[model samples]
Target: MAFVSSERIIPISDGNGLEGGGAFLPITPTPNDVWNGWAHSGAWIIQNGFNGGGKDNVTSAPSQAAQNSVTVSDPVTQHTAADPVDVYTGAFLYDGPGLKVGNGEAPMALDYRPHYSTNWRLQNTAKIGYGWTHSYDIYATERHASDVDIHTASVAEIAPYWVTAQYLLDTVTKIPTAKEVALRVIAARWATRQVLKAKVTVALGERRIEFHRLSDGSYMSPSRFRVALEKSPEGVFTASFKHGNSIEFGGPNAHASKIVDQYGNECTFAYADDGLASVTDAYNRTLTFGYTLGALSSVTDSTGRSVTYSRGSTFDMVDADGGVLSFEMDTYGHQEILSVRDGLDRVVVVNLYDVFHRVWAQQPLGDALKPTYFGYAPGLAHETDAWENPSWTKFDSRGRRVQTVDMLGNVATWV
Candidate 1:
């Protein structure tokens, strides 16, 4: 049975992505390269604009809100003086990359990509309303990246595609591959006793949702996702995501000798008498890593630029450009990252966090002020945003949206 993969992506870093109490990395666009992009978890979510033939563009799970285009006379703020704004409540989306099984037809649909590749950068923000979207399955292989459009195919395209139906059905993946995972989605709209239980599609009716790392293959960083590593019998430290791909670290060597990705790509490490000495990601690429006084002194990534870390308690980095990316930690309690500062230490990138470590509010990239506030649904967005979180423009467990409150406190509901 081909299980359906619901699409959702929450940060593996406390499932909220506000590590180091800040957001945005000026030095590197993709900061999750340290763990090879395992910083976020793919979630199972509702499908709102999908399953329709030609009403929408399911070919690409765009996060753009229809409200952005439509102007509204309704006031945004709760007060009477508030003027009407052009933006409307956005839609809820299962935003990310993903894979799908064949449609339930005879020559079942083959691998289908719901979005763009990992390299494509997109934003999934919430202003008023939200929408449903899909993302990469953690275990989806290259086999899932077919650009075939079954929803709006031309007669010519469908004729040729149907002609090869026998070949498609004969070569479909029937079981889990080592590098792939079944999409076990939080299938329901509301919270059950299991707290928004997740369900997987099965027997040729399912989709395969995958999770992708947020790295641009850059140097390592001090900020790390608070995930545990599984020690292998071979003494390797393995970190695998829920229903996504995995990366392995720390081999027989006292230190992690290698960092290997799911596709077998790896960066091998070597150490000196003092500490780490060298790292070779490929035959042609070698980097120098060193430690001083038992602490990481300097590291040079493939960019050939070295960033030095202070020996002090703060995890700060001084890039070659003279800019500093600093993380302030709490002295007491859990000692979480208090805030993140840039080289100037003037404009704040990330400011606050909720108990769940989600972004309570933060400035958008480039814009230093006027932070976008965020409030989460009770359970995981994957499991219950449809019903529990009215911010999303999707139907819930009750098959209806109870009510919606915008950033301005405007309220709307479906009765």
Candidate 2:
């Protein structure tokens, strides 16, 4: 077993044993400030909301030693889903002792919009508000689309603590779907809010289904606690959470209620399966679940050798039975890989889909709501800090408030 200590950024040492050659310097925090730059300062804001308006929040400054680089940390202090505030950007720079590095004398803008926060967060928020007019080709899965979907252009608004992300989803000529149409709204919000949370509502004509953050803080059961649309209008609507995965239904027939899991696990659900394969819309597909306890399990792999993990539940995927020769859950319990033998035109193929999950914050809808699991600056080391938020900042070297990047992708100047 090999274990190595992790540092935020590799410090550059000049011949004189001094950090040099950059506007931002990666420094190591010493004692007395153990949680200085390392402590989480706020929640993460997601960009996927109703109509594509996604945003996130960040409270602390980036590390000096890790400037222009990514430093995974925790959420801001006292953050939650219903806080009514949004976050768009954050940094991991060093600001010495006081909270503000330059006290608005300088401000660093974080950018580089990517598909998922996980992607850009890992790469560090180095690429800010990029790819608005960039053209790109995307590969589509058989289950998602028939061919590659081309993207034309996209744009976003860059803010000190907020960002507004926008993307022109379709490059090829085609009318957008309700989902696509809705993304526009989400995109708009994501562009502006610092931390953005949205309730995704699916409207199948008069029959509409909606999903939002587990706001109520009551998580007795994932299945039992959910908001329902008794009478959905032709347009879209957002719902509110009460507690424990429970929701308050709106409209005339609306009532405070909850939902039960697929397998009937009431509260304190446990994940119990890997995954299974089937057909959907007359095409081959797979359904992965968010592991909940005692949901369902199957044996596959000819000899039935496999590993499995635990999760809340699986998303629905419709496919044919024969195409799926076997199924087994990996040791992880949350994901299960399916082996489709000869189903791919005599080609042995395996397709895996990972299930995503969300945990609601334990706060009243009336409170400043936030998600427990996700927040702006969400990462392996990031945590939320609601007590003292990052109102603004300034970089050290240039003594300028605004940080400008050089052609070489370096922090060119702290203006």
Candidate 3:
């Protein structure tokens, strides 16, 4: 295999994309150092709550990824008079946690967002929230135009982290007299999109503030994780996260009014006809921002220490103490890539995103540098990582791993 070596982005600015860890630090740290959108590539995951892909009684199509279901009468009422049970046949095959009936729940119908996070890591960015992760992961949920609130439907996270999918169903239990069984059954959708109800979203990002409404009419949120999204009297949407921070959006033009934390900290930015604005934190320390249109010019901390940026055909950054960080770009075929250099002008980070391999085929400029492939493919049962080294895995038709081979050719077989 042709392995490629590369570097990771070590934020040259005191902002969001502070990913690659090294001996990097800003002149100072504060709130203004948090949400610099332009600090990294525009292609990164935004995690802005929901991604807008919901379906009513969705089914899979691809050969190995298909979730084949039969619409036979629900076993509970298949032979009786009460409205048919809502459950289907194949659902039982997937009822267990981390259990697989096929290759994966990855390539799912509800996972229609065409983003790399979803495709690569199988992460459902559509929500930053969830209810009873395990109990709800594979479950179907729905609501109708005339319904009072959105309720769980059935199909059936945190239980099975690697697998994620959610489907909407029009099936509303009649609660009529029917045969009692060990499992709950939810019928498939029989209506079209015109009348299909919208799905309620959960705001469950990893350790991020989580919010979910429970059946008893109470919210299952963190100690102070009350309202993730709420509607105002003016019909505007306001999202509040943990720590009393709030994001207000949807004004006259649908633009997001800058975020404000609990202590009343705000981003102080300047347009062109003005001097740099000062951003004061809850601690009273302030940072000054200067920009030169389309580029961030400099940032000065309250201590009067500054980090400056200069860009021409290439980019360069200098810290308060004269430490230098430089960035350059190159094109291979048609793809343009970025490279970062440290104070010594030594290459520390390289940008090489390979679309087809589904990963970055290069390792960083760390002490131990080597060509490596950190990516996965739907057809390939195994993957490699910058840490795990080169490994091979054999998967069945359903996408479940059957065998694995490490770079040393060590064999591991899974039945």
Candidate 4:
């Protein structure tokens, strides 16, 4: 017989902050007992009758779908050519199909999985076929489980005539609400999903601008000062930057793009079958890159300056003039420490970081190390070097850093 260690046991909380939701004493599950006996047991003994869990030895559990159906108070209206219908964007629960687990020889137990469906109109115009239907698969068990693991799928269809409404909205001058801005942003993001390497023209009053998505998840615009979007794997825009006056994505290869500035200066990129080979800039200067065993080996800059890199325990790079730069990475692939050296390999600058990968201090070669301290509130940094100089930074409700107050009461405001 095997016994589980006391350290391996986890104490589960009851929903009402009281142990077992004021029903019984908290049940601490040992690893061995939880894994071998109650891993997939229909209703946990501790959670029974506390938060919708059925009584002991009950075959059928209560349907969460029938219990928790959310009704939206203010749903959006989807107007069609025939009639306008109300679209619900809130969760409407339903009983999902039973999931078969364990061996086929064993009796199949009913899995009480509750699913929800949310429907919303992506485009507010009178277009008939432009909307989104979102469905989610939610788990019923695990009291501490947040709503994050709810698997969601969004199905959207954009009609050809939908562009007319979008164009009109772009040309019209009106103060949009927070909801309108959020809806428009989601609509723009949805429009670019799965449409890789294709040009789409939109007429905005007298101007016709072409929008296209690259293979590497970037968008090109026909307008001046094109905005380049870097998207994540989920088709969400992570970062956006202004490119030159004109930008075009290369063919099958993602890296072979070109950008031309307002002054007719151009920069072209070339790539090998695997990676980038060289970049020729507007001034006819070339920067070449080299790879070794599928890893970046060297980078030769436009000014004929070269930096060669080697990877082992840490990444070490040496410039052509013998200056060295070494980096130490955390498990999450973030550079925790960066050390810069001179020609003689003497450390010139050292950057340090906290566990969350925030840069806390920087030490120069000849100066005394003055460490910087950061105070965080929720998601934004609220203060920096506050322990030493007593500075306080404040952010707005939108998480934007608004103002900073130093030790001398000097206030700096950001717009």
Candidate 5:
């Protein structure tokens, strides 16, 4: 008889000394001959033709990468669909050649790769004159645009500015849906940047009005100034001017009322069902307003001064004194260009806008010729010729003109 083992098989011969002796042959197991069994602990037992039976532990073990699919609480609830919780796959650590010791601890590598992602990268290296420096760049995966290192500080030195910038970009600027963009545009149009807990000084002509914005979004302008504004809970606003003259504005559906002077001379207002009707001034003079086909047709002031408006592709307003102000509108019907003309139809003032729809220049009837240039930084207005002398107006982060520097380097600062 011949016996077969896992490593080798031996053949037996009977009476091999004879010339034609018969020998026993060895047989090997096939795939169908293998046995599959299970252990008491529920582990699978696999038997191979060459190696015999063994337990398969590789498939039974849990995978570390598979833990990424585990459920977890979302940190950012706003814009839930675009949450970045599951965006990262894994993290890795690396060290540089430089080594240093600190606090009696083991020597550690001086440089390290803290964190990185497919959408983010860190550059930390030592420079000759600048010393060691690091920068983190964040890329937009959807747009495939260039990366922006938002960690840089602004002139105001506000900390963590990148957080707000990223939030705005994710929520507003980078929104991919058209419906979301439309809704955001509408909301922004109606939103008011009300001054809350701020002190502001406004220069009008030759006077300066200092005002303080209250915490409740209300403003207080003291009696020292010529103008003041007060708001009511019902959305009504009352504007008081010098000499006890005041104007009160009602809600959107209500008309405005006014008091001319200290003697309590009242001016009552009336409005038509669709629009404005007429205003009777303190002197019992009525200023009438007329509309034709939902458009303003004429406006007559209390002093009997009237202006007639005609609307076509452009809007033209001709005053009773023969002065004309023609307005050119953009595609959205916004007044883009204004041309002021005298009775003779000669241009008096022409204001122009750049391609970006910003106020580029203002041309007034002048003897020397060129128009006045205007510049802007964010929300601050920079006009070099607005002051008494050639000067530059500087505004703080709150968009308040905080300082003014003249040509002679004389600076007038406001708190």
Candidate 6:
């Protein structure tokens, strides 16, 4: 059978917390100076790129698409000469740090981040076309960031004009009471539906679609669309593309989850648990899995960082080869081998942070086994060998040593 272990983290705040922000203390694993390196480790992962393998380079996930890149077209607009319909459409993608699990045949991959760029163009009948590209990159622990952009002009006229307005309804849990939502510039209604409750009706061309939220009184946001419908002579009914109208449902959390890397600001594990999707923090930074596990095991956000929990927790052991294994974390917060020839052999313990984006781990050998220096890089980037020394080996991407020599001449860095 599969042996499982899990982690949970929550916040603790006092009313007297600082303004513009509230202090959050970790609530688990009896947090003490022993685990003080958590945040420093998180920064390491953001900077050096987490996975042992260096495949997650800056351009690993480079994505490029021109209007004609996918399906080339220069269709004229449906506007008259007076209005002179000029359609303008642009494609943009904001790719963040993503994890690529190994198939064993390949090396384990983590924090593979590429620059996120938005490419857009605006055009009208009077002009040819113009477009611009903006790109952003985070360096050194998902904190340090820089961006470079290139603006270009095009000889081809921009795509014809088209307008799309999306109306979003959030889960009832999100809206405290009577919250007013505005659907600005309602163009020709394409489709609508109540995602959480059938009582709500969304109409497209001329029919209505039923939407519902979870039984727990959660309201389905506009993004949690089920189907598009319209009000008919008799009642709300479903509609097809008979009049060039179409309906499509947006995935859950499609809109609410986004990480903004604004200057002088840092955030991690920002997401919505609406059964939709998860979002990373501003720097796409995270710690090791071990660290995350530790945090979750105690259900306390010791770093007082932000995190989003999507669902309940379950424990599962995985082997180095990426296969399911039989190992467990004992009540005392140590890993035990369930199927080993020797009963309950000591194993590695993992703690996670930044919503499991970063991980930290340690062997259950007790404080005596603690390393002189806690290695940097989100969690334990080097599981090949147990961290054993307080050596100053971490260097910046530019090969500059990051370990600061403290007052006692002790050079160290903590996350």
What are the per-residue Cα lDDT tens digits for candidate 4 across 72-105? 3322222111011111111111222222222221
**lDDT, candidate 1, 1-61, per-residue tens:** 0111332332222222211112211222223222111111122211242222122221323
Q: Ranking by TM-score, best first?
A: 4, 5, 3, 1, 6, 2
RMSD to the hidden true structure, all candidates: 22.3, 25.2, 23.2, 24.5, 34.9, 25.3
lDDT of 3 by residue, 352-411 (tens): 444332223333673234534332323232233445434444444434445544545455
Task: Give, for candidate 2, the lowest lDDT window spanning 10 residues.
Answer: 132-141
Residues 1-415, candidate 2, lDDT per residue (tens digit)?
A: 0112432322222111233222111133333322222222222222335122233332334345325632223222211121211122221111000111111110111011112121122221111111100000011111111121123111111221123222543422277788876776676654433223223333221123433222231111123335442223532222333432222222222221222233332211112232212101111111222223433222122122322322223212112243322222234543322222233433222222212212112122212333221122111111232333222221332122232222222342221
RMSD of 2: 25.2
Candidate 5, which segments miss by more than 4 Å at Cα?
1-253, 258-262, 301-305, 363-371, 378-391, 407-410
Deviating ranges (above 4 Å) for candidate 3: 1-227, 248-278, 331-337, 355-359, 366-369, 379-388, 391-415
Number of the top lDDT candidate: 5
lDDT of 1 at 325: 63
What is candidate 2's CA lDDT for residue 112? 11
TM-score per model over all chains: 0.32, 0.18, 0.38, 0.40, 0.39, 0.19
lDDT of 4: 0.36
Q: lDDT scores for all predictions?
A: 0.32, 0.24, 0.34, 0.36, 0.37, 0.23
TM-score, predicted candidate 1 vs. hidden true structure: 0.32
Better of 3 and 6 by lDDT: 3
Best-to-worst lDDT order: 5, 4, 3, 1, 2, 6
Under the 3 Å rule for N, CA and C atoms, how many clashes does model 2 have?
132
